[model samples]
Target: MDAEQAHGPGGPRWWRGRGTPWRSTLLLTVFVFVGSAFAARMQQGERAELDLFARVLLLVACALLLWRRRYPVAVVFGTAVAVALYLGAGYPYGPVFLTVAVACFSAVVAGHRRAAWTALGLLCAVHLLVAYWLYRWLPPSGDAPASLGQELVVAGWVVAIVALAELARSRREQWARERAERAQAARRRADEERLRIARELHDVLAHSLSVINVQAGVGLALLDADPEQARTALTTIKSASKEALGEVRQVLDSLRTPGDAPRTPAPGLDRLPELVEQAARAGLTVEVAGEPPRLSPGTDLAAFRIVQEALTNVVRHSGSRHARVRIDEERGTLRLRIDDDGPATGADAGGGGNGLAGMRERAAALGGTIEAGPRADGGFRVLAVLPVKATAEGGEDQ
Candidate 1:
């Protein structure tokens, strides 16, 4: 398993790296002393009492548990073998089996299923053999052999330990999977936020820069011929620049504090008149046909951007001074059309520049469609049809 999956969230670095913690060492020390003392005490008033060798073996089995996480299978096998040897040597039963049982549990929790089962089988077989040895060698009384009850109890205890370990392992794996999924979701949200910011920045800067470029050129050309006209052009540039700066700052502020109320509402269909007046100042005479209908916020913003981009293209690329805009709702669709009397050129054509692509993206996002091309009568035209409500094929209403 990978480190992230093995350790899960909030796991310590030492545990994640498969290194033993100081607590394990402390536990090993405590178990060693306790098990050795227990084995020595079980030999009270017995002719075959535990000797120094039996105590040392029990201590060694307990100490082996400190490395269980790093070498689960080996530790389990080694501890089991030590316990078997101590028992075979006729040592009295003691807490040494406690260390072996813990080793079995660690093996399963560490994902060593085969080793755990093998250790369990070995332990059961050793218990049966020890029971038979006690029956044959120890003096038996009228009471049914006590070894039988002890063996049954130890078997049940081993099964319970294995079951609990498996349960814990399953829960840890599930928690890891959930953590990974949440991390992926957070990344997706961050990417979507970045895309939204890019679209807003492009729309604001592209339209404002195009207008300033046109007005600056006009002012330069009329500088000597008509000084008054040149001053008027300069004044228009200043006004447009200031307005663009304020809008740009507002957009940035919205991003900086998304939870705060916006400084100004987003521009929508209601702001078309101001957009038309600005285009007129840029020397384009735009004629309007139909009144805009009430629209949802998303649809309103998309409609306004489509109109602004279309008019900006007309002023920059279409050499015509006159343009027509028509807005009408028919059959649950809002149809927007803009036509100019300028010849279509390669630089202003749709599908080849950011402006038209941005407009198309806006339209498509709103479950709408856009078409822009040269008209048969020697000018350019852009037509867009947006749904009043989101379409089934377009996902949500926004």
Candidate 2:
């Protein structure tokens, strides 16, 4: 590889700061040189006497490791060549092999397995030639040929080192994959949470504000003509505003203490009376048909919101002054349908805003579906079908 590619980002932890292995390589060089000097003294009259040339060869082999983290393939072969020359010159065999092993291990872990193996094979071939045949010509006069058993033992050691490097590489890759998966999961949860909060705020404000808007208009038009009726409209406004603030505060509390139980139970079909009362204040008469079935918490909350958004749409967008809410259950499913009796004025006819979209999302999140449009008769309707048992599979058509 080129120098730029070799020294690129994400090389390895060892090459993290300063992007060099200078200190470690310098220490290894000193250790190998000093250790070899001790081995030369121990060999005494058996091997060639330690000389300036032999020391230089040892330094070259260890120094090549300085680039092992960057140019692993080049460093592996470079160290092998230096060590082969030292052995071919009949220098005493000591800590010199450590340099080649370190270089080979680095090359293998850096995904240059073929280069590391080729360098190792060449070094072994050179050692065989020098020990058995070239000894008569090159080495310190009368050196004997190496035994077959000793060669086998050295070959096994090299194989074990390569295997260990392969294992380490596998583990590093596995850890990287796990970390990526965890990060992706975290982001998915955050997006889901943000969408949920947006839905809650939309439902609470839309319904209450629509009621307050109608009452405020009534109070303005009748302020002087009928003071008692205007006073009643102002009172209705106060009640709607207070209820809206309470629901908003409840939603915010859940955000502040994420895992804790809500201070008040979530609104459900059980609160249908209160919802109807709120709609009455907006001048919409609602009739309830069919009983609400017991459902999972997620299904219950979604059912309530669908009803609320549908009624709010009627108040703000439908010209109808009357609406109908029908609830029923069959085959472990809860079904809700809200209908208004005339032509739509704005968003209820699918013109704009997230009211209809939020209702669809709430149903889909609980493994349900929402259908909304103008009826063949003379009005707009919203129909939602939710599984009584909660699930996160989004939804499927009924």
Candidate 3:
């Protein structure tokens, strides 16, 4: 049974929104009254005659169940007291035990096991006092003392009911823990995915927009004096904007249809020539050393974005017009180093804080590390060391 159902309605039809389970409790009430009346008939000669007081006691026990979820400790004790009174009145044993069992069950599952046990223990003690010692003062005159065997049987029954309730409480707690863990895991995955998207967007826009900004400036500078040169700058801006838009569309498409393969493959080190060409159009010269190596898609994309952002920073922040990129693989790791001989344009010229942070995030996701700062000489350098082989577990595309 669901843990919520333990405190509320029986099924969808019985559901009364988030309120008390009136319908199901009413049913239990009816069942207890009918069953106890039938048992009274069966024990007519052996027990006291059924009376108004006996029915009222049964009603009291069953009615307390209605508030079991709200006040479990009080309900269990209230039901136990009512049932003990009915027993002291020399009432027959039947479904009368059902009401107290349910109350104890609710209390235990609601994290009031000690209270439930205390109530149950006191009720059992009363049963013993009435059955074995106080029968002379109670109804059903001339009744013999209850046998040790019968008392033992009653003890066993109470133990079984409490044992079952304890088992239910354990299972409910386990299910709750598992549900919390699953929700936490889902939230963690969502946070990671959002971070990944932000990095992708930043890399795509920052690099392309930096190029467009440089070209637009050139176009404005030579618009009248050099018409052909202005036209060339405008052409470069158009190409950069078009490429940036396409990449942005790809990123948004992933959001629209998650889990599907991307229509355009993600950029990687194989696109280095294209990156170099774009930088050249922006009037920044790029030098490449060592051939790009085979890498897992995630590491490849991280490496590509790191170099792209480093070069974009050079174009935007560094006064130097030249940047060098070196790629090398050793053991099971790929290393990328980007360097610019720079007199930085401003104090905050280290790739706009977000760009460097994104690089660090990408490297950390791949169980890699990034080192980026000004060189001992008047220059800035970014070095990333990433594992060459691993499932692209941290990347969306792979």
Q: How far is candidate 2 from the true structure (C-alpha RMSD, Å)?
A: 4.3
Residues 1-398 of candidate 3 have per-residue lDDT tens digits of: 55445444321222223467689789999999899889889988889887899989988998998887777788999999999999999988778888889988877777777788999999999998999899999988988898888788788889888899989878877776788799999999898878888899999999998998899989999999999999999999999999999999988777875578889888899999999999999999999999988887888888899999999989988999999999999998899999999988863322356988999988888888999999989999999999886445555343
lDDT of 2 by residue, 217-329 (tens): 89999999999999999999999999999999988887875689889998888999999999998899999999988777778788999999999999989899999999999
Candidate 1 or 3, higher lDDT?
3
Candidate 1 backbone collisions, by pair:
none
Which candidate number maximizes lDDT? 3
Give the Cα error of residue 55 in candidate 3, in Å.
2.0
List TM-scores for all candidates, in order. Answer: 0.76, 0.83, 0.89
> Candidate 2: deviation at residue 219, Å?
2.5
> Candidate 2 — which residues are off by over 4 angstroms?
1-49, 63-78, 107-137, 142-146, 347-352, 392-398
Candidate 1's error at 69, in angstroms?
4.1
Q: Estimate, for each residue in 1-398, the C-alpha lDDT of model 1 and write its tens digit.
A: 64324553323233347666558656765866676567567655432466688768877787788888777778889998988877666666666777777787777666676777798789778767756645455422222244557777787878787788778767766775787799998897787667656777777766777777778888999999999999988998898888889878877776675589888898888988888888887888999999998877777877888888888888778778899999999988999999998875445322236878878887887789999998989998999999887655443544
The count of residue-pair clashes in candidate 3 stands at 0
Instruction: Tell me which of candidates 1 and 3 scores higher on TM-score.
Output: 3
Give candidate 2's error at residue 377 in angstroms.
Answer: 0.7
Ranking by lDDT: 3, 2, 1
